[model samples]
Target: MTTHLPDAAPTNWVDRHAPSALRPWLKLGRFDRPTGIWLLMLPGWQGIALAAAMESRWPDPLLMAAFFVGAALMRAAGCAYNDIVDRDFDAKVARTAARPIPAGQISVRQAWVFVVACAMISLAILLTMGPVAIGLGVASLALVAAYPFMKRITWWPQAWLGLTFNWGALLGYAAVTGRVDWPAILLYAAGVFWTLGYDTIYAVQDLEDDALAGVKSSALRLGDAAPKAVLGFYVTAFVLALAAAWVGGLGPLFLPPAALFGVHLSRQAARLDVRDGVAALALFKSNSLAGLLLVIAMTAGMWDGPASAL
Candidate 1:
């Protein structure tokens, strides 16, 4: 009953290079679309970079590497869990119809096993961090578990995703500094709005499908006002991010990179066309670069040395 359903990205490695037996599993985990990995990792890097800037030091290489691995595992686990929950809905949506669960390549029980396996791997990685980071990791499970149901109850599931996705900002800071600070809080909030903006753009791709599926999304809620709503989300993210750097005392050098980051988001908002799914996806993916720019900005603040060091 396994069907060779279409992948979101036709040329992705899972489709092109993965062995047939493994493709279903890899696709289930979304390894075929690398954007989610980058999106998930950037916030962690931004957290590391922010903490490093605060200390006038380089980010810990091991910590950054761990975040990369952890994000990949956790994201996969999340996608599997989401798929299992949304299997019925996925069968109805063209974009998700070919997914492992919906296409009958994986049963709900098998997907649950995969989720547990991924979670265990991610937990092992989480345990390598400090007690504070470890606690944060455990706390994050609530958000992760609750996210799939958000769309069923609220019009702003993307908002819930915003809260869930960027938790690394707090966890990363705690990992580096062993505690939370105001700047870290601001950075986390900034990431929330950033997710809100980009995920809303991503939802544009499934507007009609989501409507037909009875799933609520910001895209459906905003209707023709989605473009303006995206602008508002992006603007709020930029302002909060600026405040985070300023409060962290990252120095004036943070301005240029931050400006560049804002500009990238601005361009996405400016060019967004809800009716154009291809363009919406492209704009959504561009946030990865926008996130990298913010990380660079945070890291660059250390170049002049911590203001205290100077």
Candidate 2:
């Protein structure tokens, strides 16, 4: 017999207001847990914000709007694809056993159709950007396609996810400026470590199940050192973000907010209890706020004037 988790927070709008017929599909796309959408969207925004700061102006409203839509669609598509690829593994993991696909709420064929629909919508948005951004968007599919398989081969699938998820930093900058630069590179690296940290926390929720199922994860690899590893990843991410800002020519006004962002990451590390799955999941979700803080810092940098003015 199959089981189904409620698939939404008790108070989530999807749970409370979505049409009954659509709920399962929406849940299959992870619309109920919006944190992943934010996490996926922010790197793109940060890249745009970084570019705008370097140019000493606000981000392009059109590009920002496009990214919001594209991020949502693409993130949904990515989740659908991941679920499709991991359905077998999902059944063996406690936290994931009740997911739509594994619980028989959605058929594999239906999920593929959903993935295709989402990708087509995202493709329409991508086509509006320059050739460089278009190319980057196409390239991202390779990462997305390979990601679900990483856990079967490596102890650090989260690292692969970091690389995949943070591709937005590069793509966003390219979309706005028609080229990738040092600042974009740095920002991409920063996002990678940020994902590494948060994803590791997320994996903590499945440590025992993963171990039993022979899945590999950073949480499993780090063992008792997971907290320290989280701190290390966070610190690296903070430093790289600062470097990206500096390279983008952000002024002194960027420092305070950036420091605050660092403090938030540090606090997450300090408070982490890897053994507590609830706490681990909460900390993972909190990175959504952490992402917003980075966005604020980057946006503040826009008006602070360029590095030469500092």
Candidate 3:
């Protein structure tokens, strides 16, 4: 049987059935824990929905499929790159010591190869999008490259991750609308704050290990106030999401799901417990549902449209 990482679900498919030789590679990409992929991809979907609503049309299934593939590839690449940069720190942390890199399952050079392969595939998808979306995809490279170092130099690496992961919102909107409008920007901002909240909760899982490894995080920086900080971040995220809907001229039908989204976030904050890592992880993973709700809110906004397109 495959040895599961501390963070991976025991029954995850990668551990249950993946070929032994490929298991290390899949783990390197965090395929054993698919929550990150959903978190990374949903912002793009929300943007697609918003852009479609703006045009009073349904989101393009072809474009959505492309983004789904691209997001998975890019997230895998990003995770491999992060592992390459963070091998040493990861070795020092109990939660990360068994990762493919730190545990000797994959060589740094091999991981680099994986990163390149995934990034090249993602680039191929980007090339099929509009010029503005392609440019935004290229620009996101800087954020991805800069991310692993943020934990070393900043107390809030989650903020940088927010910027990096949610960039898909802008790119997706540009792909459909061929322009970066106020709605996309606002939606991107909301995604950033949403990430800030959930990732802060995730960081709680590493508070002790991170502090011991000398890695700074919003959770460690806030100390006992981590939950409160998460609450603040979620509040900002909820407000910005609504603002994006309003500015995008969404109708009243969007409010109910949006309210549910807000309630979901509120409950996460209310139940947050900095001392409980398992609960923190559960809370972090719940953001996927929250992201889907926001996507629904955006889709619901298109109740009235001049015309419709698939």
Candidate 4:
């Protein structure tokens, strides 16, 4: 009997529609929870949008599509790698005990092969980008390799994840312009705080399990102050994003959508309930919309001539 992951919806396509023989493989790659792909992909999209807007055009469709596919593959690979490293701890956690590795649906060797396959395909897509992007893509491997160990060493593993996941901001910008810029750096910083906020919310679901298993996370660190901490993280992210816009000379027309983006983040922070795992998961998933809102704001910023909002 295959076990549906606790965090995955019961009706997830992997469980409901994927061929039974392939379910374990798909689940190992986390195809059952696509929100992660969006979360990972959006930063790259935002970076592409910012670069294109600065060039006075919309984001390139080809680049956007490539990032989308790359994000999916890389996220899958990262998930499998995390599973391989965390298998023992996962078995000890209620929510994670059913994962492919821990549940014995997939062997560790097979999982490693899956990781390599996904990564090689992602590298093929990366190669289509410019040299700078290709270099950044290779550099990101160091971060990915280091991430699984972060929880064991720091209470702020989410901060590390922020750095790792948001590197796409730099990679995407370089992919378009063949170089990095201040706007890309600022956008990358914004993405970091954004991840810090959302991933902390995600960590809330594992508070008890993590504690019992002796791992550290921001949610465990913040305790009842999680909401306020998230609020701070989101606010910083919002301001940094706008700063990137201003620095990029995105026009005044960017304000409306940017304001909406900030408001959406604020609402998520306000509704956070660390004690309620279900609500926390919902709040975590909602970041996908928040990310899209920023993507729109950047595009709207380009709609007008490049000038700081006044």
The C-alpha TM-scores of every prediction are 0.96, 0.95, 0.96, 0.97
> Which pairs, if any, clash in model 4?
none
Best by lDDT: 4
Minimum summed lDDT over a 10-residue window in model 4 is located at 1-10
Which ranges in model 3 have alpha carbons more than 4 Å from their true place? 1-5, 304-310
Instruction: Single out the weakest 10-residue window by summed lDDT for candidate 3.
Output: 301-310
lDDT, residue 70, model 3: 93
- Better by TM-score, candidate 4 or 3: 4
State each candidate's clash count: 0, 0, 0, 0
lDDT per residue (tens digit) for residues 1-310 in model 1 = 1112244778787778889999999998999987998888889999999998988888998999999999999999999999998899989988899999999999899999999999999999999899999999999999999999999999999999999999999999999999989999999999999999999999988888888889999989998898899999999999999888878878667778889999999889999887888888889988889999999999888766344431
Candidate 4, superposed: residue stretches over 4 Å from native: 1-5
Give the TM-score (vs. native) of candidate 3. Answer: 0.96
Clashing pairs in 3: none
Worst 10 residues of 2 by lDDT: 1-10
Clashes of 4: 0
TM for candidate 4 is: 0.97
Model 4 lDDT, residue 275, Cα? 77
Once superposed on the true structure, which residue ranges of model 1 sit more than 4 Å away at CA?
1-7, 305-310
- Candidate 2 residues lying further than 4 Å off, grouped into runs, are 1-8, 308-310
Which numbered prediction scores highest in TM-score against the true structure?
4
Provide the overall lDDT of each model, using Cα atoms, as 2-decimal numbers.
0.90, 0.88, 0.90, 0.92
Q: Candidate 4's residue-wise lDDT over 215-241, tens digit each?
A: 999999999999999999999999999
